[model samples]
Each structure stands twice: as C-alpha cells, then as structure tokens.
Target chain A: MTGPLQQVLGKAAEFGGTALAKLQHTHVPGVGQASTTEPREVAAARWRAVTVFRDDLAGPFPELEALGPDLEVRMQPAPGDRGTELSARFHGTPTDEQVGELRAALRRTKQLAEVGEVLRVDPQPHGTRKATLQGAALEGAAARAPKEGVL
Target chain B: MKAAIWAGVNEVAVEEVDEPQLLNDHDVILKISKTVTCGSDLHLIGGYIPAMRAGDVLGHEFTGTVVERGKAVTKVQVGDRVVVPSFIACGHCWYCSQELYSLCDNGNPNPGITEGLWGQSPGGCFGYSHAMGGFAGSHAEYMRVPYADVGCFVVPDAVSDTRALFASDSVTTGWTGAHLGGTKPGDVVAVWGAGAVGQMAARAAILLGAEQVVVIDRLPERLAQVRQHIGAEAVDYSTTDVVAELRERTGGRGPDVCIEAVGMEAHSTGIQGAFDQVKQQLRLQTDRPSAVREAIRACRKGGSVFVLGVFAGPVDKFPLGAAMNKGLTVRGAQQHGQRYVPEILAHMESGALTTEHLATHTMPLSQAAEGYRIFKEKEDGCVRTVFEPGG
Candidate 1:
C-alpha cells in the first residue's frame, strides 16, 4: 500500500466511524433519496440523524404510525442496552421546519415507550443545576470529589 | 404564582415567580395544598451546597391536588390528592428499575454538571440545590411533577395531609436508614440528631423490632418528642457523654446499629465541633460530620452503620480507621422515597406513624421567608413548618 492510498483508506475509515457514531447512516436505502433538483452534499447533510432515542420496554412497539409513513420511526434491540432502539428517518432531506417537529415527536415517543412520557419540569425543567460560584475555588485548586430491594 | 424563592444566602422570600408548566407528557400540574420545609433545605439556603441560583423555588416534602396532567400520566389523575416524593425518579432507569429512586440514571437532565461534581450523576430533586437535578421545589401554588405516574402517590382520605406529608422524604428517609442499618429483633439502635428524620429513624428502628432505640440531640424539645412520641430513650448529647451512655445502656457493647439522621451542618458539643466549624469556615470541608463521626465511633464492632443524612463533599477525619478495624458495613443514600411510599401510607393508615404533631407551624405561603427564619432559628420550638400554597 502506497502512502497516498493508505492515507485515503485511513480517512475513509475515520469517516465511517464518525458516521456510525452519529447514527447518521441511513439503514433504509432510497428512503432519503435526493430529488433531481437537490445538491448531493446538501441532501446528505439534511438526511443525517440529528437525534436518536433507545429503550427496551416489555410491550408492543409504540404506535407512532401517526408520525406518518414518510417519517419512519424504527425500534430494534441493540446489544448491551436495555429495551429497544428507536430512530427516525425523514423521506428526502429534513428541512429546518421538519427537524424540530421530528425531534419533539421522537422525544415524546421515546419517553412514552420507555418511561411512559417526557417527565415534565415546572417553570422550565431542563437547566443547569449547578450552584453559581462555589465550585470556582476548589476547581482552581484542583478540587476533587445507594441500595436496592423492598423491606 | 407565589412560591418561596431562595433569593440569596440566608435570604428566603415568598415571591411571585412563574408557576410551573407541563414540559413533558408524564408530567402533572399539582395545586400544592401542603408543603413543608426540610432540614436539607437549610444546607441550600445557607449556601453550603453550592450552585444555588437566586430565585430557586424551595420546598421538597409536599402533598397536593393534581389540577392538570399530561396525556401520558395514567397512574394519577387530575383532581387527585397526592403526595410527591422529593427526589424525582424516571421509574425506568437502571437505578429506578433497581428501586433506587435517588440514583435514577435518566432523571437528571443536567448530568454533565452533576457528573463533574460527584464523579457520576445521581437523580434530580425538587427545590434542592441545582447540584442535584434542579427540579423546582414545591413551595408554590402549582408544581410541575415529572413522571407523575411513577413519583406521585395518592393519599387516602383516612390519612390527613399533615400525617402523610413526611412520607415524601423525612419518614421514608428514616425508614430507609433503619432498613439499611439492618435493624431487627433484639438489635439495639442509636440514632444521632433528633430532628424529624432522626425521630422517624428511631421509630422505624423500633418498628423493625429493635430491642432498644437511643436518639442523641441537643434540643430538649426534640429530645422530648423522641422520648414520648417515638418511644426512644433520648440523650442530651450536649451535656451527657453519648458514647459512654450508649455503651452503659447496651451492656458494655455499643449499639447494634447506628443511624446518622443529621446530615451535614451538625452541631457538636466537643472539640471536634470547633474543628469542623473552622474547617467549614475556611472552606476546607463541605460538611460538619459531628453526628456521622459520632455514629461511627459509637456503633458496636461489626454493626451496620447507615447515614440517612445527605452530605455533598469531602469530610475531614471520617473515622475510616474505626470502620476498617471494626468491620463496619456502611450504607448511605438520598431517600429513595418511591420504594417506601406505599408502605408508609399503609403505616400511616394503621396508626403506626404520627407526623401531624411534627407540623408545628402552618402558615400561608406568602410568609415563607418568615417560616424559614423560624425554622432556621428553631423559634418557638418549631420542629416543622407546613406552608399552604393555596392558603
């Protein structure tokens, strides 16, 4: 293997790893196919998975069919993780308008299947819980830092 | 909506903050009827827990009426009177599946911060410092309860709100401490700190078949409560030699189990207390482990040691030597109230527990700042202050 060819192979492997890590590679071929008018690079970027939800519940698959056929949600088991794995695919590339809707829908469906629903927060639930200024000193100084069963 | 806001260190006020909204499908909107101040909240308002943002709503132990529910909430319905546990559990995480509610893996939305703080993140808690999952506390007219189907338990009409409120945290935590302490028939238990949690721990030990229970505290009022209501021998540790007295009462052997119900910020009557004061003042240690250190020192060799009190960071002189030499089995946790909620309700219904008397002060939610002042100063022998959000 020459240096140039070997470098190209290495780059390809790195790109594959990144794609798998992102879970962006389309499992369903022709599902997110580009139209004749669309640019290939733009279409690929839009088709990449922006969010993924995985869980294992001992019941029927979430009837997210209301999510529509073009917008597909798949559930399957991944090794070493509990419950099912769920991911969504948008037919063609997802527009900015479609992405937020898909993320919200996927989050809702996953919460429903896994824990029954998105655990809501009051006055806004999701935020940083850290205190304002206490950690600064210990951090500057290089500061360091449950049972089962019913009775 | 009005709620008790932690405006700054040593400053608590009832202010108008936006009432909680339903941010998830499993969420429920509760019109809080009864919310109580917890001892742990002191750590928050004292600025010891760190990362407490101004305007953080504060109150975790509460009972309420569910006024609204998200589409997915099925276990509880709108208009149901319920008591929500302090620590939020997703009910399906690895920790929740194991019935360890406080350690629920998926419950804390801000895992990155907690992971940075504690090496690994635990579950979120209401109105507790943001270091835990920073869910808003319940000292408000309306509370947003996440995973209502899992965390909210219905209160039976037979059990009054006053009696059932402790089921959310104090009662369950004491129960957990006793249960984890391996309290059983013929076992002698020693509990440090006669606060609400301490009294409950003493009672739980007795209920679990402990032959004798001894509670140590400096407050006479709390000691009396422990002696009379909890039916335990109370030690005025400030004057008496607690370690010596326990050994004498236990036939020259220390207590079979020791429960440290007083979390951080324990008052001590000895030189160690002074040391802790200096250390805490110098920012050398995050917790004053007077009760916990005493619990370890006083437990019988080979006895189980359980810390029901929560401590955030490093402590000086934890008595690791005593633990290793004596072969002590130590267990501690934030209360997994979810696991014990049903049992506690049954206990309340059966008259095995009485918490109504603990609610010594009931005030309108608007007086929250005053309520915290009385609680912090132990004014009028106040053991607990119950705030009525709808009062």
Candidate 2:
C-alpha cells in the first residue's frame, strides 16, 4: 500500500473504533440503540451498572476500588432476587477516557466474579489480515470493543 | 491445522491456521469430527453482516471429540464425544438460569460492537462475526470451546456423529422456534423455507403434536426432502400463492403458528422481490425480510410467528400493520441451544427426528470453496455440505 493509502486506512480503522463508542452515547432517530437525549454531562453523571447474578455480593471490590477515590461505587439487592446491582459514577466531571476505563473495569469485575476468569479472544486461530479498509476498520472495532459499550 | 476461512466478500478458502488453546478455566479443546454449513453463514460470506473481516474462520454447527480440558471443567471430560452449541454461554448467568442462553450477559467479550448496533449485546457465537464474538469457528480440525459444561453435550451412544451434529444447531434451533412459538396439539403450523432449519422446524412441530404442518420453498429438491424425510406437506411458492395456499389448506383461518427459517437473503416473486433485491444491493436495507413478511401475513389472528432465521439489521417493507391488527405475537432470537438440545438429541436417537438427510453433500475441508459455492447457489440439490476437517 502507498503511504497515503496506508494513512487513510489507519484513519478509517481509528474511526471504526471511536465511531462505535460514539454510537452508544448518540441518539439517532430510528437508527441507533441509544434512546438517550441527555447532555454529555448528565449521561456521564448517571450511575453505570451491571446486575450481578449473585445474591451475596460482598466487597473489597478491587475493580472499583482501583478506580481511585474520586469514584463512588455502590451495590444494592436487585428486585425479584435477580442479584445485586453494582453501580459506579465519578464524583466530579470525568473525561470520556475515564468513563471508558470504568466500563472496562466493571465488566472485568463481573466476569471475574461470575466466570472465574476474564474471557479472552485474541491469540486464537485466524488467517491472514488483509489490508483492505473494511477489514482494518472491523479489526479496530474489535480491538476497542471491551472498553466501549452501554456499560 | 487446516480450516475454512472467509478470504473476502463471497470468498472462502481452506488455510492452515494455529490451533486453539484453553483460554479460560471452563474451556475445552475439541478435535472437530463434523461441521456443516448453515444458511446464516451465507450472510457472513456475502458481507451482509459488516462485522466479519477477511480471514475469519467460518463454520459453527459441529460435533467433535473433546481432546483437552481446563482444570475447572469437571462434568465434561477428555475423549467425550460432544456436540457443542454455537452460542457460548456462561451457564450460571441470569439469562442462562432462565433458559435463555443466547441472551447471556457474560458470553460476548466484545460487547460494544453489538451493543452499539442492537442496544444490548446477546451472547457470543463461534465463527459468526465480531458483533457476536471473535471466537474461532468449528470448521477447523481443532477448536476451543468456552463454557464447555454448559455448551457441550455428550452425544448419546446410539446416535452417530452425523445425527448428533444437527442437534448442535439445526434441530435445536428448530425446536426453539416450535417450542417457544407455542406449537400445541391440533394447531396448524406453517414454515417458510424448506431448508434444513425449516424442515427441522416442521418436524419439531409434528413431534410437539401439531395436527398439520406445511413447509414452503421454491426449490423442488428441498420440497421433496420435506415431504419424504420430514414427513410434512410441501408448498412450492414458485407455482402457487403461499398465503392463499396456506389459508386454503387451513380452512381459511390461516396457520396457528408461522415459522420463518429463511434469513436475510430470502427469495420472493415479482415486484416485491425485485424491490428487496435492489434495496439490499444498494445498501438501503441490511436484510431481505420477504419470508418474515409472508409469515406475518399468513399467520391466523392471535397466532404466533417465530423467526428462526438470522437477520442482521433492519429491513424495509415490514408488515407491522398486519401484525398489529391480527394480534400476532412476533418473536425472534439467536437459538438458545442449551435449552432444547437434550430433547432434540433424544428425538434423534429414537429416529423420530431425522436430520442426516439435511447433509446432502459431504466433502473434505479443502473443497470448502466449492462446497460453499454449491450451497449458496442452491445447485446440485445441496441442502448442506458437511466438512470433514481431519480428512
């Protein structure tokens, strides 16, 4: 690939990764899953949570505690005995990177509690990675998937 | 090890790839015995699902012998002949606890891709796409299976590999549609697409005590298989109007349950068909929902419609008004195989559910490109091409 082509493909891959994360926060009429029209501040202010399937969720939650003292973590019994609702939010305005970190931390905490190990997908069997723009974009999206989502 | 992979759009090839290892304590490695093509795989191959990249491994419905085991995997053992479900699920999740394994929270490691598209991610599926999970598929000689105790079921001693193989996906998926669509005694059931999933769906309805079942398709070979092997009535939509024919067969009340096994690439006739084809090709709509539209229209008032096909995104010309007016219950999902595989295997053992006929063509993994060509083109009466990776 030429230098210009390589640069364009690299940008496309980056766009693929960030665009997915952007969609979670953007409410597109009839096109996106995000139903929220809240401002960025309000969306970030709200508690992000996962319903853990365990009734007895005690902590020493190392995942949340590692997020620093500025984060407030809480847990409550979920309705109908579904499990505990583990939630967290920043004390002050947080950057998008901080929010992404929180999301990844919460997911890892849930996985470690439920499945005993964080699930891995990389280093698995796969063929050549063609240098096409679409393939590169998808590769970027998969790379950023764990740290990006409604979580 | 040799495996089939998606090289590019409408391109498939056999390549030597690295073998999978135990990624999680609950995972196991399987030396795959039999893996077959599914209608859903065509969506990935054709690039209709945007998440698939080139060189992604491609088979999912499979049976294999457990070659290695993780330390925490207590129930399943090495050397166990098992048929693994395509959707990987953490057995103890709330959704898995509720028998909705496909909706598992812990399955998809890469949740953002699907969460962005569908609001929430379901479970991860082997070899489907990154939107589901980036797990390697079973088309290879050996593959890793996560959550083995929940997803892998030991094949019965009496059941052969071919028979037990369909139980992994086709039969279980069919049973999911029939059982969840609320098929009951004396009800008339109509299935769209006389492919393997459609045939199996009709058979499942019959086993569930439906008094009448009819399968609709354009292929004469598949229709013949429906009547001969599945023991159900067949409707050739090429010659007859499916809605009118179904109504006439059911005494004008229409079918009590309508199941669509045709996925995003459904075939139709006249202007509607041309319209869908053009829209899909132009990237206006992500899927062709001709079968779903027909099902909703043909279903009786207060009837239930279950979608057994795999649809990626939105479709144009959906029959929402008809569904609302008729009080139809429309539901669709990726198959929750863990919930239904046991009963399907039992049925297979008794010869009550015959799925070996669905594997119309069998070949070595090296002929994967040709196999997919025949299966996709529907030439040579190839309902499915079962790949023997080790051969």
Candidate 3:
C-alpha cells in the first residue's frame, strides 16, 4: 500500500511541475510576438475574385428580413490591369447571391489574370468590400494592382 | 482624554472621553499632535451623511506621535512621529498590494463589505459618521490606530506638520486626478473648482508639464490664489460662460483634459438651459444634470475627464451619446493617500509644491470648534484650517 501511494504522489508532483512549466513558457516575456508573414499575403493567395455587398448581408446571405424594405442598392466595379475591383453601397442589406454575382463579373472582366480563388473579403458598415484575387501562375499579382476602391 | 465632538450640524464641542487602549496585536496608541477638519466632515455635520450621532468625533486628517505599539507591529516603534493616511488599509490584501489601499479587503473595520470607516458604522471613520468606520478621530489627546504599520508614515524631521498635513488627503487626491487623467507635456488641462484639492490638481498639472492650466471657480479670493500661487489661469463661472470661454481660449478646441474637482455637490444654472434646449428639439428632460455635465461637454474629443469629487447615489441623465461619439474616457477613484504621500513629501522637501498658501487659518486645539465654524462659513478668507493639538 505504501509503495502504491508513493507512486501516486510522484505522478502528482510531475504533473504539477509540467503544468507550471507550460504556463510559464506560454505567459511570460514573449506572449505577444507575431509571425513574420503579413496577413495580406495569405489573404491574396486565398481569394481569386472580389465581391462587394451591403453591410447587413456581410454575414450568412439570403434571409427574408436581412435587408429592410426601404433600402436602395448600387454596385460599381472598376476595371484594373491585374484584376477587377468591385464596390457596393446600400441603405440596408443585400443577398449573398448578389455578392456572388458581383465576384463573377469581376473575374470575367480581368481575363488576363487567371482568378484562382477569393483571397480577401472586407465588409464595411457603410456597405463596401475590398477583395484581393490570387493567380496560380502569377507571383506578386496583388502588389502590382493599382490602389483604389476595391470594397 | 479630551476629544473633539460634533453636537449637531455645524455645531462642534470638545469633551472628555475614554482613553483608547490597544485591542489587537496590530493596534497602536497615538497621541495626536495635530488634526484638521476636512470638507467631507461638513457632509456629516450637515446631515448629508446619515448615521452621525451626538458627541461623535469630527476630524479625519491628522498626524500624531505613537506612544505604544501592538506586539505584532514591526515597522513603527514607540515615540515615532507619523503622518496617518485618512483611510486604513491592510498591507496583505490584493487591493493594498496593487496600491489601491482605499479598497483594501482586510483593512475596512467591517469585514464583509466596504462600509467601515473609523468610528461610526462598519464603514468606520475617525470622528465622522457611524456609517464610516467608527474609530475615534485623532482630534483627541489619544486615539487607537489599527493596522498601524500599514497606514502610518514616518514624517521626515525636516518637514513641518503644517506643510506635510495635506499628504493625508487633499494633496494625494490632486495627484491621483493628474495621474489618472494622463496629463502630459503640452496638454491643455482645465480643473473645475478652486478648493484645496482643485488647486493641488492645477499644481500637479503644471508639474506634469501641461502647457496651459485653467482653474474655474466663483470665489474671487480663491481665483486670485489660483492665479498667484497655483500659476493657472482663472475662470469665474459666475460671470463667464465657462464652456464658451474655455473653447475660445483654446483655439476653438476644448481643454485636452478636464478634472472635475467639485464632485456631487456641483451646482450649476446651466442645467435648466440645457434642459430647455433639449426639450425644444428632442423633447428630453435634462433639468437635473450636475456641473460634471459642463466638464464633460467642455472636454475635447478623445480627451479624458478625471472626477475627484465624492458623489453618492446613481448619476442621472449623463450624456452617454456624447461621450461615446467623442471617444472621451471618464475615470474616478477615491484618493489613495497611502500610495502618493511619499512622493508628495519628496516634492515638498524639494520646494517644488508649496502648501503654505492653502493654510489660510491656524489655531490651537482649544479653539478647534471655532476653526470649524470659520471654515464652514468661509470666514476670514479660510481655505484650509489646521489645529495644533499639542500647541
């Protein structure tokens, strides 16, 4: 019985020591450091098309009460050499399908850039989205685009 | 032993009382050498604070010589000259460890809640109301101080009691305001009220390198002192539209920081005007906003407002929308006297902060009641009245 009890106490001490070490490692000194690769780089690689939508439809799309009845919606897409940029404004919400259609239109307009995926989507409260499209063959396609209204 | 007692609102008397004895290992018996009445004492005398009884002691700010110490007391020895912080604190509690000594968990006389001040209720206070800890005040010949090691400060032999007295409350309170407001070099700071605390706030602002300091008050004498002694511009709220005047002086932007030194007793005629304006436009009633309203409105966008005043009950109809829209931050706490007294004493030693101008009246302990009366009536240009108990 004494041998078994001694083993249990030894295990408890080891567990406590390990837990304290992990806590000290994670919480002390270097807790706030960030990795080197910028968030924009990852965003550019994931999105092939840009989509602009109203603020209310930025979350899950296509619900009856999402957009109020009185809102007026407008979509404006500007053509760019590398990819097309889309901007939208509305008094209320918009459907997800409407946002998807805008992305398709942008992809077709920028045929020189092979649209790989939707790399970024930013929803502004005043109804705007700035998205970056990625291409498999083209390196630094995002950096080459002109900076203008993309959302 | 003789003690200063309050007979009724605005009435005070001195009478013989029982001498204090140490009840715990942490207690010490102090023979008070000096004591002074605080403005908060008026709250009790005027019945604004409930639970005050006849023959209760009336002083909170004091300094004394310790005649005896409990067995557990280690920091201070007998015959030590100590300046006692107004609030008692236990050094071991989380609040005390963080230097928020006023909120010490183990310090308050009432164990379960925040009420103990010195003598009155579990929120005991020395010589104030029963709602505060009911500990007898230092106005007496002898008094008991609990947790003596934690709350008492040894006065440097070079410092006079008159100059070091304010380290108990007002000076530290002013420093707390400036510290919390984040006053920095080139910031424009405005302090509302010209009381001793307000004057100290202006001084702290100057010390912190505020480019301009504006002090607002209606008293001509106080305003003059603010200008001559505190070296801050004075605004007489009685004659001047304070908000408009401040904005005009600050190049169309309000003060970068505003300190509300007046607290809950702030009275203003602008409440009716604000209410009328809101009623005509938004159909809102704002007739009851305090002077803090003006301070909030006069603060620049993204500025800070430090409230150093004592207030009771819920604040009514504050401008939440304006604070949010302008990104203004409001912060307030009771003065942590224990934490700031040492620094204030150093400033005093260096001749950097002069409190002599604030001591407009001084008298012996025999005339203590009259001192209270003079200060209460604001007679003889009294800003602060100090009583030399041993004199």
Off by over 4 Å in 2: A1-6, A25-29
Which sections of candidate 3 miss by over 4 Å?
A1-151, B111-125, B270-289
Ranking by TM-score: 2, 1, 3
Candidate 1 wrong stretches, greater than 4 Å = A1-113, A116-151
- What TM-score number comes out for model 1? 0.77
Task: Give the alpha carbon lDDT tens digit for every residue of B150-224 in model 2.
Answer: 999999999999999998888888889998999999999999988888999999999999999999998999999
Cα lDDT tens digits for candidate 1, B229-278: 99999999889999999999999889999999888898997689899999
Residue-by-residue lDDT tens digits, candidate 3, B74-164: 9999999888877776554345656877765334332211211111111124565433444567777777877788778888888887778
State the DockQ of every prediction: 0.08, 0.79, 0.01
The residue-by-residue lDDT of candidate 3 on A13-101, one tens digit each, is 44433332222123222221123433433423232233321112121222212433432333334333211233322333334333333
Q: lDDT values of the candidates? A: 0.75, 0.90, 0.63
What does DockQ come to for candidate 2? 0.79
What's the TM for chain B in candidate 3? Answer: 0.89
- Per residue, candidate 2 scores C-alpha lDDT tens digits across A52-120 of 899988788888899899999999999997998999999888888898889989998888877778888
Clashing pairs in 2: none
